[model samples]
Target: MVLADLGRKLTTALRSLGNSPVINEDVLKKCLMDVQRALLEADVNIKLVKQLTDGVKKQIDLDNIGTGLNKRRVIQTAVYKELCRICDPGVKPWKPTKGRSSVIMFVGLQGSGKTTSCIKLAYHYQKKGWKTAVVCADTFRAGAYDQVKQNCTKARIPFYGSLTEPDPAAIAYDGVEIFKKEKFDIIIVDTSGRHKQEDSLFEEMLQVNNAVEPDNIIFVMDASIGQACESQAKAFKDQVDVGSVIITKLDSHAKGGGALSAIAATQSPIVFIGTGEHIDELEPFETTKFIRKLLNMGDIEGLIDKVNQLKLEDNEDLKKNLQKGRFTLRDMYEQFQNILKMGPFNQIMGMIPGFNDFMNKGHEQESTKRLRKLMCIMDSMSEEELDSPEGHKLFKNNDDGSRRLRRVARGSGSSPKEVFELIDQYQKFAQMVKKMGGMGLFKNGDLSKNMNMQQMNQINGHMAKMMDPRVLQQMGGMDGLKKMMQQFNQSDGSGRPGRGGMGGLGALGGLNFK
Candidate 1:
């Protein structure tokens, strides 16, 4: 299944669980366990995972014992509450100004995608009608100037950087002056990234902050850093008041649990997530949806946002074709085009609950290759053939079907059997589209109602079972295996209906991982 499809399925499952009138402790425990396992597989921090799960468990227990609620309702409430607590707690949302420019400084370790994120952020703000400009103060890196310049060019945003300047503070101060004079609504400062312990780099950041006086300090961290995120967050917080975080390389991280929780522990909200290396791949952070996605509940809001951003409305004919069960090769090709917008197949699928675990196992590269090949074959078809397969002249008066098969095979660069397989796959998908009442599959309410939550839970449960230590080692002793297991267990036990494990450990209040 596609990543969006998997996410849709997970969302459907969670909604089903949420809508349940009764809450069973056993069921809640099992669901929480599944969520825990999913988060662990997503590369979230183990300790943070524990804190999140414990919070949910505590809430569940309180609801069950104090309120005497149903199993499903209690589980839903606990899931919502705990996810919000871990992701945001007391974190405030960023409200963009209408009349004034907002300065946001990007910081991170070297190669953490800070420079790229700056351009992406610029594009994001530009899309919102903000006059955006990028300032490159990364004089420390060898090719930083060229990198930021190239990105600014692609984004069509103004950029200010100098190769000869040794003083980053002077560049920052001048950049702000230039932006102000140009009347730009936003100025994004791309600072030089360094390791957490680089005292000199930290001092430079302080100097830049003093010069720029940015409204928001964004720490860009790699999602794949896993357990090390705690220390990284602490280090950055000590050096500067990091107002928010942007977790990059999310597509590569199988366990993304630590990025948000670690920063949240430091009292910083995650403002954006970098799902891919592309300039437009950054997304605003939403706590509830993110938690649901982690637990394989699916992110309906995310899917809708993607559809809206992709301008799916322009493809009215494709919608009609899908609804009429006439999903021809042309329609299939168009769907592929849309899929590309969501990033790689594996990365997209990772956003869905159960599939995330599989994606982390390095299956994304393989999936991308297969999808590319499939698309290539579909692309070879003529417009006429794609529009009306039965009326095509290529297959006229061919009783034995050999000539027709050979023609399609040659045109699509595939064996006759492979061509037939593609046809069969398309036909099956067409049937599914018809069964789903056509284009209603894109509607949040209808799509959620049609999803099989039981199947999703079963799949997640099976994957979790397969990920058990004995099974994992038997398959192949994976790197970062222990951390993954710990995160999984924590998510699984997150929402049990009663003061579940809350009092066992003291609140992790004011505990700095650095």
Candidate 2:
């Protein structure tokens, strides 16, 4: 079972009790059995599965905590906690010191994606204002140097490697020395891997480690390797002090559950997970957030981080325009840019409860393509059109709507109807932003600030109109939305859902707000 399947199965097992009037030992036993079956099939170790089930049982003390507690929610929460516990190693991963050069080393088996991960990590640090560099010391692989060089060059990151040097240790030492002298804060050394565990491989890894004396040694593991992750991790840990682990290739049909349990066995923190082949696919892993996403529960904090990141990319002008209730085609284009920067759409949607199922239905790519097409249509428009107060007004003026639309369609190679559709979208967006701006609640998307009952109803009504019927039904229509908002308000003490959806971005329906 893949992790997604595992989550579904475990959650399904609890569905039996979700509506049950009474819970007894027999029902608990059955639920545990179902959970055990799912975990075992997901390639999770037998011992770990047994431990998790036992923990859940112990935690759900029926008589001790009685009917006063919602038994259904308690039991489900118990399972959720135990599942998250299995993924956590109960220790913090090593971190690089700011303003100081931190020598880090990457190690893994052949084809485990160590080189790609090195560049990914380097790019991650590079984006965060660190002077990061990569050292390709994997002389054993046939085209390792070229591959690393190619990726680093594409990312515009400084890289050090040698085509003539046969000794990886010497290259690693010299690379580290040069980067240190140049005051690079993060120097990542990509080491060699073997087809399988061997004395020669370990010896080579040991040589590179001794030469560089890295501050952190990260062991990369292929998630698809499943049950073998434990042995491979142990093999590397025996040789070096593996402080962090990065699991790659989990976006396949691999039984990722095993890797989680096995990595836990290695007593190292999982610092990141590779979700795809793209360089931006690598994401810093948070145990609770990861489990929440896996179980189709939202990762609110992660969503906030993504929004914050986009805001840091010079959104002051957009914010100012939104404050003045001025949303134009240019604002729409800016929103398109923000959508792209928010990482994958499916990943973003998965952070909202009930959205993972929506994504799994295959709308992720379709929506992205549509957004891209709309952007292209906007790009073909003239500067006057993009900055125009009303998109439809440009076509509706004395110049004639059809002729103006034809010009745009001709330039963009899109049908006139497609251009009309884009304008229609822009119109709806402008209307919403105008309303938000009128109420003076447009301060950085603080949706609930100074909001009265009528204003809440207005916001809720617009959300209902924009939301798909299916999504509305899942959220229990307006009643459910009210409940969700109430819960959010209670927990956060912010009077309402701050950021609501899209981090603190609030309403992008007008390409407005932060």
Candidate 3:
């Protein structure tokens, strides 16, 4: 799970301890210890975790009744604030000059995912209605031109690069001129990733910076490098006015705790996070929401925003159907499609306060498969059979339920047991919705409140079984799953990874599961 997500779960568990007229010192201490343990287990820096815990404790101890804020709330808020401060380095937003194209230069060490990031950024701006072009200045790499060109082609963005041109600075200058002539709104220059000791390569980067005169210079760092990421960031900052930092490979990093700390030490605001290696695997760094999630607090604002973006209101018919506890197969199919738009199942689960921890336990893939199987079974039902309760009754009574089940099983290429399982699961879900007062419960936050420890544990256990790599292979393997995740991550200009179709399953074998 993401650090922010882990924090959210920890905070929620702490809040579960009732608020009182007076702060319970023992309970507070226990809560803090729990928080500390959770962070440590997530590979957060020990020192940093202590600093955070201590800060919260100090705030709690100094609390006054007159402030109107409960001691627990105060402590929770303080911890949230501190985490945000550390995660975000206070870097100014990239503001492009009006009526003029802005130039962005990408820099990083070798294998830090610089080239891919450049293309992704261009794609992001292009989606924002900007005419974007890419400049391949990394003549050092033999196939750099082809790589950038291919990415540009995939994104349908323009590219300017010449294999014959040996001078990096001259290429950048020409690229910029060509972009100007082409009337592109943004020009992104991709430079070769060079080490600090490579004086000649560094000099070339500086020359390109001067020649291109980019409005924004972003240093891409690998989060997997841990503490060393600090020095690399600092070295780059010293050379160029490093406007922001993009830490990549976060999805695979065990010690991602250093990610925030490194940005904190460098005094660079984290503008983006690269969660995976795909072109779209980036997310905007939201300080408040991230910190809140890390502390196990619900990001209500983020949730609201997502709801609005998805135009949930437009689906009034579906909402009404759900409110009546009359979920049909068609409704279920639409819900699956909507969830797909929201990104990966793991990511969506992370947005929930307590579920984030369960997700970090590495059970997301399993849960996703179950949901997909359920969706497929629903897909096999006819429109009339789905819409009418009587139709379902007849279908189930005639021993036709068996025949229909077999048909669904065959249609979905799944077992009849799987089809039966989906029907049973949806029946339970429908019952829960009815008990909770239907879809209104979601808006009123009643759904979250009703989610008890037992239910959460059950969900986690099921998720664990579903996400097992072996189970995924039975479905289609890592290549298929990774592509799905990439699509989920890259849904918006936020740069989350895209589900790159079904070809990414092979890469899963190399994943360090632990």
Candidate-wise lDDT, in order:
0.63, 0.77, 0.64
Error of 2 at 394 (Å): 2.6
**Runs of candidate 3 exceeding 4 Å displacement:** 4-76, 97-99, 126-130, 314-327, 378-391, 425-514
- Candidate order (lDDT): 2, 3, 1
Worst 10 residues of 2 by lDDT: 505-514
**lDDT tens string, model 1, 151-183?**
789779999989888999999989988998888
Quantify how close model 3 is to the true structure by its C-alpha RMSD in Å: 9.9
Query: Once superposed on the true structure, which residue ranges of model 1 sit more than 4 Å away at CA?
Result: 1-80, 126-131, 154-157, 224-228, 253-258, 316-327, 350-354, 358-363, 389-408, 427-514
What's the C-alpha lDDT at position 34 in model 3?
Answer: 76
Identify the superior model by TM-score, candidate 2 or candidate 3.
Answer: 2
Cα TM-score per model: 0.68, 0.92, 0.71
Q: In model 3, what lDDT does residue 420 have?
A: 70
Q: Is candidate 1 or candidate 2 better by lDDT?
A: 2
Which regions in candidate 2 have their CA more than 4 angstroms from the true location? Answer: 312-316, 396-399, 444-448, 470-476, 479-514
Q: Highest lDDT, which number?
A: 2
lDDT of 3 by residue, 50-71 (tens): 8888777666664354566566
Candidate 1, overall lDDT?
Answer: 0.63
Q: What is the lDDT of candidate 2?
A: 0.77
For 56-114, candidate 2 gives per-residue lDDT tens digits of 98898877776478877888889889887887788789999987899999999888999
